[model samples]
Target: MIDLDKVAHDYGGGALLSDITLRLEPGSFHFLTGPSGAGKTTFLKLCYAELVPTAGTVRLFGRDLREMRRDDVANTRRRIGVVHQDCQFLDHLTIAENVALPLAVSDRDPGAQADNLSELLDWVGLSAQARARPPELSGGERQRAALARAVMMDPEIVLADEPTGNVDWEMSLRLLQLLVELNRMGKSIVIATHDLNLIRAAKAQIAARVLRIKDRHLQLAGADL
Candidate 1:
């Protein structure tokens, strides 16, 4: 769970997010929508402790972000997965190898997690492309691979930033289904996206709360949306 209290973050120029207090409970699903430069990315970074807030507090799973040491932060990160907008992968490594990179980075042997990796690839519908390189993949395939990589460690929370931004409507729904599946399995899901249609689609399958950032604040989106 992530708890933010009166969080205000400024990137030198001005306050990007201000007076934001929110809590992500276990098994909760949320969609964050806002205009470009509205601090959606900043909010996600703060949630995962990638950037410390300029003011206020952030506590992840009951531990204060400001109080955690480097090792503590690294360890905390293992419990949370992130899918970035840009699905960057090493061209030399096969999709399977790239998906298993997180295990290696965590000092866990990839060989030990072969079964899990295989299952994950299949879950994301990328089993057929397991040996393909990143450059050879379509946008949907790349995004699916990125999703596989993010959850390789079996994280408790999954934060996706514009996960379906590059894919078509069909592919977007496919990716959304995967996240919804994760939520059903008890992983907290937070997706930062501008696509209202995607949010509306998710609402039909799950009780997803939609939040919007405006005037440097976070508020629950109207039921009409």
Candidate 2:
């Protein structure tokens, strides 16, 4: 569902990524690991068409990103869900409103959304926090809220950047469990993180392939994961 072919990104004279190639299929979960400036985030952005590669190609859902018009990319994005490290949200909006924004933007039936919205909140253990504003939630609550928003569209692909970065071990495990459940339902999942402990934990829950960027190329991560 996601393919990156010989992709490279350059800013001015500096190279952020090079000779990277990857493919993520349906029902597969992947963990992407690398050092601080090793381009893990850049790679994830490439997968979702957030940033165009300075070179090579990114093919998502059979369409070449390079040839896709900007509006086309935006439309295609409806089928993809991304959870960021910062968990962007409107400070004034309630948690439920933020989570339902994706569906609203897609012009889905509001009445039809009622049930799914409730179920999603329950799934993330956020039903009680639905009417609360984004700023009122804790770090873990906000992270799960972000996850719920990402999947609100029932997207075919889910990309999370450092999903458990600001949370404790218990919350991290809770977040991982949510991702695992989504994968079981056939959503393609890619989590870009530098946390080896999280990767180790994930290995025990699902058959996820770990890929890393090193020496300017993408490679299968060591079994140490």
Identify the candidate with maximal TM-score.
Answer: 2
lDDT of 2 by residue, 109-146 (tens): 87887799999999999999999999899999999999
Q: Whole-model lDDT for model 2 versus the true structure?
A: 0.91
Model 2 residue runs over 4 Å out of place are: none
Stretches of candidate 1 above 4 Å error?
Answer: none
Give the number of the best model, judged by lDDT.
Answer: 1
The pairs that clash in candidate 2 are none
Estimate every model's Cα lDDT from 0 to 1: 0.94, 0.91
Q: Give the per-residue lDDT of model 1 (tens digit) for 35-107.
A: 9899999999999899999999999999999999999999898899899888878899999999988897897
